[model samples]
Target: MNTSKQRPVRVAIIGLGWWGQKMVSILKSCGTELEIVCAVEPNPAAGDFCANNGLTLAASYDAALARADVDAVILATPHSLHPEQIDRGAAARKHIFCEKPLALTKADAERAVRLCREAGLVLGMGHERRFEPPIVDILQKASGGHLGRILQIEANFSHDKFMTLNKSNWRLDPQEAPVAGMTATGIHLTDLSVKLLGAAYDVRVSCETLASDFRQGDTFSAHVRFKGGGTAYVSATLVTPFVSRFAVFGTKGWIDVRDKAHVEAPAGWIITRASVGSLIEISEVGPAEPVRENLVAFARAVRDGRPYEISGEDLVNNIALLEAIIRSAASGEVVAVG
Candidate 1:
């Protein structure tokens, strides 16, 4: 509603890891509305990246927060530090856009969301899969009754990139990435499922590590029972070949979506009706710059008072289900979401 298209949003990128660099590239290459004014990274190696991109390398997060030019902060830091970083960013009256999981625990996520709301700041989570064309169609049809009553959903996001990660990598640490692949890839499915079928009330998980060299577990599968009477399954693996698939099953028909492990390539989807024929296929070949769209959305919220799509309650509920999955895997029992 704030038609001020000329307004610029100054943003700071935290963390200088591979994923952080990816965000930087998207913002620079896609010509989005966001401007990367500064970056908070402790690694001296990232100084050149900052210098080349015209971003000031802040000595610390506090230093970045103190800057007047920064209107929002995109946090790509470790999961352990998300809650504290979000709290600090909100306290500084800056909009916060954090990568998925928000926080590892429900308590931390609730605190982060609460502080952001209390400070009247936008809290955006980086679950960009919702922006995918196929995913958009699924959500649209499901809401429009084309999919009838949704009964089940299945999603699996797996890649072999983790196989090369070293022990020092935080993702290889259990404390940082729990329930095997849940934190890395499966969380997207959980977020998407929650979007389709309210919050999950319980979770049953079976995860294990078959690779002896892998620091963290390599395989994970979780079954979620939603409060809205829908069931979902999410699976992820580190040793398998790259594959990404999502499907929604309904009483009348089903929609299946598949994509490459990388985002640069196009994705395809299929809609099936028992009486209509075999299947209808749709291929999306254009660039799917979800990260850019996500950043632009955040900027719109900051500049024009437009609400960020991900709400505080949704953020808290996402982490709640994640915690339940982790717990279920550990105890080998179905855990009730808190």
Candidate 2:
């Protein structure tokens, strides 16, 4: 979508962890729209990753910001650091593409978004599920009135990475990942629900530790009431095997997109119509590469001055929903989303 004839964007990648490295690898084959020219990582092991990948290792984010060639920054750092990193990147007048949740709190998210708006810089978040093909298909049908008055939606995304961890990590901290699985998995479905069902006004949640060696819990679920009269239920567990599922029920029909637990597996879907006799099978190979597509979308937005799909209000609303979910879980009462 970045139809500009300008040269490719030279980006500085901060954080060289697993997700950060994944982004670097994707950018290698991510075409001519963007390029990773430098990286910042304090870990000595990341030095070899940078060297092997022909990237300059900067001592700190300030060093990366000082480079004139570095047109933007891709933040793959922890969730808590996003607000400050985005603030610094925006201050430097560099386009920013930060990984999701944006910020754990509504105020932080709003401030980060406001800073980018005032700086006239493109701000993109890593809600990559927006680029998934099955999601696109469902959205198209809903928009076309084919789904016919979407009544309710349900989704569940879970994985066992928390149970698999033996050593202490940031994810185990309540400050970093409060609400446990909600921050890790439920947030993705929450973003999707926000995009599809509009802003949620009331939230009721149940979060408990079923099995975990860490201080945080392993299971979480939330029921949300949208301002538009739609309802949604989302659940996740940190001790379960990998699984991702999304379903929507409407007056005319219903659709279920079941994604394989493994990241490498292609997602499939099934749709059932009230008038039809049997469930319709929709099989498709080549699930949309969400991470790659999200990067490209950000590149296009930066290069062409195009608007990113998720609006500023959506960012704030999503965080409000997250905060409300946590509050409800703690209070055992339905919390009103601001």
Candidate 3:
């Protein structure tokens, strides 16, 4: 087992929307050490979620941040709103675990990381794919020289429908959705791509405007070139029926995760690796509770004061790469991503 043992983290979730509510549900089951102390949400669904779970619901993040009871804050608000919330949480001396992209722009993402650093707080971005037990096991196999020399990976995440019109939230807006479904979700693929493939160098992307109702970019695809002569050509389509999932390919084998559909569409996962004698296929079904692993990882990171499997720098760089994809899609050119 890992040597890090942290006391249960005192957690608060801001913007308890669809995903945010799930975060709370998973954290709730995380034993007595972990706790959901407060919630900051404008929507009634969030309030209901907290009430049903017996969690304290705060009317605003400002109030939640001021409270001494909250030890950490999870920013599940919106893409454009992430940076400021993280900044506020850091200033309030709370550890932060944000959903994705970090922010709508690279500068904003950079500032979020910088602010978190200044506060000496552990900043975790929710790229929960890294926590998938099978995925973790696969990465270990590769590092153990079972894959010989790694080559390429293809990761994809798609979404077509959203249950947002009822809520009157920012996600339905183009500014919040940003570069379509990719920024909202596919950054997981890019972040995973970086971990498996090495530093992504140049990104060439293409996005189609599939939704007439949506104001900004809707459907997006990108090809990221990794420095080690590997590639992660990732895509996110809002027109598709599936939700979040990931796939990785190495020289000796390939692994695919089919996230069980939950409106979130995680389904299950399948792993295939090549051995000296034959091919091996291994699969693991997801939990009735999916977000528990993510919260536990964060709580452990906070308690241990060590590096997590995921980080803010990775989120910023992934957002930077996503931003490059948007630029490339707009300009029809290859964008160099640092």
Candidate 4:
């Protein structure tokens, strides 16, 4: 491991939207470990603000990408644009931490991954939920077999219309947020379920747009059949009050993860296991830190030290499943994802 704790990472933040602000804030507030190389947002207001705050301001992402001063980029752009952004960033040989729904198509995702691999760059999707403390614990236990051959997993995410990715933004344009709202969330939920279930096998999905004003998919449900006959259920909605819940059901016991804004707490997971006489509650918060830890992991990988605990392969698979869900929804039938 590169114990060079003094080494700082030069990073640029693209897009200054809602989530983009979080990324920008996390990078800027990371003390000395994260150096703000540039701020690239089409919004002049945002760029001017970042520049006023001592960050190099770029008019566009391409300008930042062309700069050799930056070693990495955090892209919290919209979903449909992820593929092109990732590919272009990889070509520039910049380590990447991008938002979920890697691409509108699996082909684009595969291309982005291949390009990054060839460029010898780290390409991490912003599947931030995966790094949530409770979710991490649940996955660790599931992978360790402590969940006893996980039989089923459930994922839920609900947000009000105002919180929808495309609610008031350009994301409402199908071309900009393809696969509709599915990419906005199905990407995260399905990917999460697969991680806990071990593999994304067969998937049957259905979707509907409940709101007349909503641009794309409003709510979706998917039934995923994993290897070893395990089943996983996934769902996302834009009409409900905010509720985030994740659970894994195994032959021996089950694990549940729930959260709202921060989702899982940094302290640890509020884990529950059932027994004959009583229900056991285990609070296991592993290593304090929330979203920042994921950024640190990315920083370590960018330094070519130890690879981030999560690999690029896991990200690619998630995109694959994401593509299949869209296909299933589009075709009104089940779609298989490798």
lDDT of each: 0.82, 0.82, 0.72, 0.71
lDDT of candidate 1 over 1-338, digit per residue (tens): 12245757778899989889888887786464788888989888898988787778988999999988888899999888999999889888988899987998899988998898888888988888877777877889888988889999988998888777777899888899887788988988998888888889899999898864665578889999989899999999988887888899887678777775465333444333331244565544345667677777778887888878666777788899998998998988999997
Candidate with more favorable, higher TM-score: 2 or 3: 2
Deviating ranges (above 4 Å) for candidate 2: 1-4, 264-279
TM-scores, one per candidate: 0.93, 0.93, 0.87, 0.88
Model 3: ten consecutive residues of lowest lDDT:
1-10
Candidate order (TM-score): 1, 2, 4, 3
For model 3, the superposed segments whose C-alpha errors exceed 4 Å read 1-7, 44-49, 163-169, 243-245, 260-267, 275-277, 280-290
Clashes of each: 0, 0, 11, 1
Model 2, 1-338: lDDT tens digits are: 12244787789999998778988988886888898979998889998998889988998999999888888899988789998898889888998998877888899989988998888888888887777777877888888988788889999989887775644677778778888688877888999888778889899988888777556677888999999999999999888888888888888777887775444333443333342355665654454467788888888888877778878888888998998987898887999997
Cα lDDT of model 3 by residue, 1-338, tens digit? 12224456787888777788777766767995478888888866666666788988887889988887678888888887787788778878888888877776778888888887787777877777777666677678777877666677766677666533533557657666756677667777787877666666898877777654555566777888866787777877766676555666666666666665632434556454455556666656655333567767777778776567765566667777777776787787888975
Per-candidate Cα RMSD to the true structure, in Å, reads 2.5, 2.5, 3.5, 3.3
Scored against the true structure, residue 79 in model 2 reaches a CA lDDT of: 85
Give the distance in Å from residue 333's predicted Cα in candidate 4 to where it truly belongs: 1.4
